[model samples]
Target: MSVSTDLTPPAVILDKPQMAENIGAVARVMANFGLTDLRLVSPRDGWPQERAWATASGADWVLEGVRVFDSVGEAIADLKTVFATTARPRETRQPVRTPRESSRILYDDTASGLKTGLLFGGERAGLETTDIALCAGIVTIPIDPKHHSLNLAQAVAINAYEWRTLILDAPPPRFRDSDPPASNDLLIGMYEHLEEELENGGFFYPPEKKRSMSQNLRVMLGRAAFSEQEVATMRGAIHALARGRGRVLAKLAAERAKASSSSEPPRGE
Candidate 1:
């Protein structure tokens, strides 16, 4: 099957959220994963809470476009399929799906023009039993039984990441905007320069082992796969070191000449 490019994102419905910070965090996570539609069903404080904006951390777009409704039914009235997220299971007969499974279903449904929504409960208590009954399915996060409680934003992030995978088949590989590798000519030149320096510095001890030592050095330098700029920088470093050695030798030679003259007898004598 072909990948769907223009799939509609599901609406994020928060049912009776308790704190403004939690709402802000939820919006931030939703923005991170590309879910834009945010709906609130009777937030404890009120809609347009000033604290939410501060906690959102620049995810103003989600907060700006958020919709407020008096009840869950009204909030999700336009949606065709809805899934409720909860850590615990209910006694109802609705099918329970993990975040991953639910995301896959949401992807396919949205691709086929179905308006979908994900319902989340407040921070203190999760989705109400009555609210869970209204959804088409229940989305349960698989957390450790010893510490099953999850933050409101953390729960949203888990589901959002799964939703992101549907758009991108998998996480992309590491990318860098690096220049292309240095050409063979530049690499060869760099290797020769370093080898010449090492030779002058008496780095390769034992004349019999010079060839092997030189080959090992070449291999090590080649492993870096330097760029053009890197090659130039390395050559500059080698030249500077060579100049420093030359200056030291010249100074010693000048000092020896002065010592020899001081010990010579005067011409008049």
Candidate 2:
């Protein structure tokens, strides 16, 4: 589905977080994944804690605009759909999904003009049954059953990363930006120049192998997909080598003539 320009991702609700450090960590994680809205419900240490900013690293904006609430109901009052993040829910029959699946549903819901949110319990007691009942669904992380519990910040990070992947439209890796590939005419001209020099240098040894060798050379060079500038660069190198060969031949001719004159010496004698 296409992302809408006005789409706002699900807000994150932290219920009764025990540590100021965890709050800062959550803020940092939220910034990493582009989640702008953060709500704190019944934070144990209270709001406006200076220690949080130390742990938030450089994510000051999230902390600067954080919303505080006295209860879970108030925290998500404006949200249309909410998902509770829990390992397991007791007596709750709501639909449950993994992090990735939950992200997809949230993305679609937000695009359709619905306000959404993800509810996370505190570090100590976790979400109460009443709070979970308010959410439409449950998001359970697929961790090893032996250790299903997650750190408060770790849980937020996992969900945030999954959601970010849906919204980010990243391009494939490249070494450097380059112009379009050279035209067929430019390619052919480069090939002919290189082949002419090779032919003069007796590169296509066996007379019968010339055709097959030329075809192989063309195939190999074509695989580079050279840009116009690259083709020009290759042609310049070929021209320089050809001129050097001409100079070498001239030097050899002069040496031969001097030797011949010496052998015909004693003309005066």
Candidate 3:
């Protein structure tokens, strides 16, 4: 087993795709899961499609090197093994395998330096019985019984993600790009500052339930696992809110004093 993320990706063949947009979407998803090889068999809209490139967004490389073929058999001639994607079972006898199972076999083949391919049918109609004949096995994705058909891109994504997971090792994920998680002490300090302002503002008005309210607040904040920067930002926002409220209180007090003085002025007159 290699610790490297890089591995050989299997060839993805789109058979008689009806729409150029769907082909572009398929390319996008394939790029997302690190699969590169893309083959098109008799696209109805023809090749070098402007819509495909536009829909691909920034995945121009996938479309740039795409191989167009006249038929499915011609495309898989170089591949040692080919798996056809199909939703419905045909009357003819062909071994059907799940996405994971098919991907496992693909991984094994690539490990031993064998080229493999995944065949996907058009958007309107899935892989035909005639097309499945060229494949070593059928890959069926288990979906809702009532509506089993999947989008062309979604089918590619499911299989590509599986194949990559089995063949490549992802580095243990971490928030390396952002600040580390805030310590318990820092989070507690933020909570205390916020609660103090809330109390001063009479947010915890019910004296009997103040303890329960604080407990709930603490529980909610504790589960957030805040980052260092996040805690500081929360504290800053609390301070600003308290300052604004203080200004309001001062304004009200001044208004009340002026009103009282005006009322008493009649005695001096």
Candidate 4:
């Protein structure tokens, strides 16, 4: 049977994932819990591999719809609420909740028409401090301190199972028809505009430094899928800033040209 959209789907994001087998295991877990959406952040091994498919078993559809991204921000762009799954605590002091508690909140939020997501880190190392900072909350599975770290797939499975258990007993939440978030074209255009403005502002000058500057900006913007309103708001701010600088530069140039002309004698005289 095909995956049903009647229940609210939890978007599962894998950040810097290590192997295809783990990805497949994640797919299987998601399928077991009736969650379908999967987002990948910078997978070390590319998707749709034989190992992943073999591990996925009956959940090939999840693999088919899995979206691959280059960064965590890109993976959760469209989601309004996001939970980062991590065992280790970070310096930022964000709200940390157990998997069951996080699942209940997610169930409630999604029932109220919020788009939600869960983020999982790589196998060896969990989510970086910066990545955890991006989430609204952190979901940690309770475990013995000596063996706190769980496998990547196991972590996802635990969260999914909790969420599923919450949702299965209740009447499925009404499927809200959310407007398509910012289209790829809009996002690409915004990126181009920002890069150009940064170049004009001398933020990314010196050809040697341009690569890092561009990359940093890309990572900052790629995290969430922006809405149309969000894109417009960002574009407006960029334009306002750029216009202010443009006007200042134009005045300076005009003043320089006028001074040069006044310094010259009349050509016909």
> Model 2, stretches more than 4 Å misplaced?
1-5, 169-269
Candidate order by decreasing lDDT: 2, 1, 4, 3
Q: Cα lDDT for residue 137, model 4? A: 68
TM for candidate 3 is 0.60
Q: After best superposition, candidate 2 residue 57: deviation in angstroms?
A: 0.8
Clashing pairs in 2: none
| Cα lDDT tens digits for candidate 2, 148-198 | 768988999999998888777432222334454554456667878998999
Supply candidate 3's per-residue lDDT for 108: 64
lDDT of 4 at 237: 95
lDDT of each: 0.81, 0.81, 0.78, 0.79
Model 1 lDDT-worst window of ten: 170-179
Best by lDDT: 2
Residue lDDT tens for model 3, 123-164? 887776655654666899988899876799999999998887
The digit string of per-residue lDDT tens for model 4 on 1-269 reads 33334557779999988999999999999999888999888888776578998899889999999889887767776676688898776555567899888887787667766678999889988788766655666788888999675788898999998887776666454454554346445666687799899888888768898865665564456455466889899999999999999999999999999999999988895
Superposed Cα deviation of residue 213, candidate 3 (Å): 77
Which ranges of candidate 4 are over 4 A from the true structure? 1-5, 88-95, 128-135, 169-231, 263-269
Identify the runs in model 1 with alpha carbons over 4 angstroms from their true place.
Answer: 1-5, 170-269
